[model samples]
Target: MRSRHPLRIAAAALLAFATALPLAATAQAAQPTAAAGGVLYKKINSGVSPSWYTPEFERRLLASGTDGVRLPADATLPGGVTAPQAAGLVQPGIRPGQWLLTLLGSDGSDNLLGWCSANFVFKKNSTWGLGTAGHCGVVGQPVSAYVVPPPASGKLPGLYVIGKISLSRDHGIGDDFAMITISPEFSSWMNPTMPVWGGPAGVHTGDQVGEPLKHFGHGTLIGTGGTPRVGAALRWDIENGAGYSWAGAATPGDSGSGVLTLSGQAAGDLTHIVADVEGNMIGVAGTRMTKILQVAQGWTLVNGSLLPL
Candidate 1:
């Protein structure tokens, strides 16, 4: 059999999602238009249909009974090999906040392939995990995140590690989202809470046009507002995919960044891909967290702990 390109796989998966509209809830949509401040908004419906994952495949995967979804043995993941961790003793930190994850290549070298974010941190059955964009890693790719270097002493720089990606939904498989299962030993370092502007109780459906959206991302390790309120409401580009667009062009490492409402509700995850015009990214789109948690069985969307904004 011939190998398929990742883009091709993503396109196929999107097509499948588009065809499965009836499976999704009916959402009121608004007309797509170019708005001020470079924000454009759109909405889409949900669906059920026959695609890559047949009724049987979906049945078994969802029935796996694990804390995470389990794929069949034959299911192919990108980067068939894992990225090797850097040699020598290193103290990397894990936290439930915006993160930058580096995707490794099969050669165990930094191919500089994918860069994304760990949107949030959550615990299931006492296990800690980080959520991110699915395209960021292969099934078992060696992923890394920023960690506070030693010392309850003076604050120092951050560190990185071989944090592995366990569960994922490739664009070709489901939506573009994945869960990075952190080791239970690293529980002290992770927090699933978020900055509160209001009640971000749990996963809620998306908003309509003119609704304001703020995306949290690592812009620069500098500046007071470096990582908050990064985007404006756009539109939902995909029909049943539950995809939403927003103003702002996402940089190379911006994928998987978490988008939220000013009220602190979860919005969606930043996709690695964006709509560009003459090399300028006009807007970015992502799979709604509501839809992701719904479709990706066993994945929980919870408000870890309430924190004031």
Candidate 2:
């Protein structure tokens, strides 16, 4: 069992909107299950509210540690293992649309601060990184993934430390995004293609109102059952670089999940659940890819095998 620590950070203001409604960060835990081949994997189902939700929210730390069960020394690597593998053995890769856990600090404790879905894979110079919501973590917070890669050999899936939140911002709408600098060991396993929905042909800019959008997120509360959602862009605030879409519904833990155009162009990332004055969920809102690229400067979107748009 991994040792647990008390999360020390206080909740921060989630957004700057004036709607007088509860603007919750769609970041929470989901149920864990055993993977195929008897590979023991666990989802940090700890019900801790993300630190960016509200001022009065208190942290609910997980009773058990959140570390993944380690793979054995003799375990076989997954197929298609890339070069420069760790420990002279190839391992499965981490890809977009996977579940990620945000730890409190750099000490590697199993104390889960929060969890969110990964968006896209990025490359800045030679460094690789994963994209998530800015509210998912603050700068310097450690990150991990509860990966369940395809069953290969008899090796099981478990938790792994991918990287840390090197850049983050949540200045209200259109500015909620973060970048996790991927560790060298996991770089070879990085896959740019989003699970299920393929091709994010490239970074999509400009307005796309009324256009069909596709999203694959892991919000446990949204009840997606691991299936992608399709909806239309409700509106686009071009000047502010935010957009709202009715892609079914984006709930807690869905923040940072990427959205793409039907033609497979990377559109944006889910940031918050839009609500009305009475706190009724209206739609899901996110920062546009154009804005993310603009703010996350120097980082280029890594392209994957293109699929028919």
Candidate 3:
């Protein structure tokens, strides 16, 4: 008989932060208005049900960050891929677990493929970037921040092209991540803080079963309203370099969310959901940070503040 439960990688749905010190919770604002800044309008099917990818839903996804841009040398790019034309200014205070990233199709079409949560901020020398699941897109696929929601005016919001998939490893459980090189035009909006929790004080190496894990994701299904999820590591797969947790389960559209230990150490990236043959949800699994850092050599996690641009 087939195993009762099977592990499934949480695919992008087309659809945060902190370690120990508790920061005062900030009220998550709804979608940004044209008055907030100019909105980019586009026409494309977002793969899934259009109703599910609405503005209210995007608001539930949470909005953060400021506006600015600057290109950096040493930025990684897939051969022959060039950055898309930059659009709307990124909101101030942009941080992980905040913006919903919509991945455009790789076939040179305008189709809105799917989306995933932004995980951590990283810097390789002077270049800054964002992290998510490798399965989100292939190398050189264009990516944009899902900022403005679908408006009543009936025009679909245009994308704020941020960068392209610079590096990715969708091999399997212990190795699922992608790095996006932020276009210099949108670089200054980067923030290293996790939303609710704080430090990610540093990178965590091994597993600590029973230790609580904290996550802040914007998956469309859960509608968290910008709140963080709390759960504990239930087990570890040493061979795969992955950890499983029961509570604080990750849902579809939550792929690539960052996971941190209670004390704020960066743990790993949530890659998939564990479920049973009956289709009952079990828990969530993530690649350990130890493995991610090892595979993503040369890139270092940015903790508190970003170095001067």
Candidate 4:
């Protein structure tokens, strides 16, 4: 079981934005009868609520931490996995249209693991259409990926998959990381209209320090994300580092989770989604929404579901 290129995993909009700012940059899978990645990687802690937390986001917390919360794990490498991959482990508090990520193995060979949350969407019939960096979907390239659905969710059940990604270009996978549509039958257990963190739709997605954020998972209660409200796209010293957060902080297993406002509004997906999946923050993952939809393998938010727009 190999994982997606660790080196390439860090290739996304975060890198491009970080480069422009003269700041540094940042940074799944599964089994069904078996443990696909997302099932095992559960959020153990509670996301901290930043003062900047907006009502818009707090709404997302509506059903967070209830039951069925788990994180997806990647089976590519030798446990060289994403710490935040656990988001899928615990049942999310929200519904469909929630964001989800499928962590793959090192070599992109199989449907090993995955991670997902309220802000993401889990699609079906994606054998020919798995998830990949938005940039991975080139105009003329043949992009085939992997997918795996999560086990039956007692509460907010849904489909999941570990994506085996293949990119046609280097940066194509970035900005436009892509995920195809899922079938409604497999997407039954979970809803498609609730706030991922308990917030409403079309909430603020961009913000800076002193802002509020929160993470809700399984590892620890209040033992999760949502910290001091760090700056958005902070162009820091590449020499010292970039986007280093003293605030808007996070803990392990909080990776790939969306950062919401205290109001429960969906703010932005955490970058590199990991604080230290390895040990340091130098190499983490970041999700680029704007670019994610620009790819040939389009993405859409339909009736709260993220499908091929």
What are the C-alpha RMSDs, in order, of all predicted structures? 16.0, 15.3, 15.9, 16.4
TM-score of each: 0.59, 0.67, 0.64, 0.38
Q: Write the per-residue lDDT of candidate 4 for residues 216-287, one digit (tens) a residue.
A: 321112122222122233322111221222123333323334433455443433333222222222222334
Specify the highest-TM-score model's number: 2
Model 2 agreement with the true structure over 1-309: per-residue lDDT tens digits: 965321101001111221233334332222212222222112222234333323221122121123344433343222222212322112245766766668763233445446577888899988998898887888997677755434442434655667879999866457778999987756556778876678678877757565667777666544222336666666666234454443335555677888887778888888655554434344566788888898899998887666421
By lDDT, the better pick of 2 and 3 is 2
- Give each model's whole-structure lDDT: 0.48, 0.59, 0.54, 0.30
Q: Which candidate is the best by lDDT?
A: 2
lDDT of 1 by residue, 1-309 (tens): 999654334434433432333211212222332233343322111111112324454343334321223233343212221112211112333433444444343232424434455676655676766787776676786555544433452334332442567777755212777787765545555545543322235764756654556555432111111234444565654545467765543433445666666566777777633322222334457778776776556767657444632
Ranking under TM-score, best-scoring first? 2, 3, 1, 4
* Candidate scoring better on lDDT of 1 and 4: 1
TM-score of 1: 0.59
Which 10-residue span in candidate 4 carries the lowest summed lDDT?
Answer: 26-35
- Scored against the true structure, residue 265 in model 2 reaches a CA lDDT of 89
Candidate order, lDDT descending? 2, 3, 1, 4
Worst 10 residues of 3 by lDDT: 36-45
Per candidate, the number of residue pairs that clash is 18, 2, 27, 130
Runs in model 2 deviating more than 4 A are 1-92, 105-112, 148-155, 223-225, 242-244, 307-309
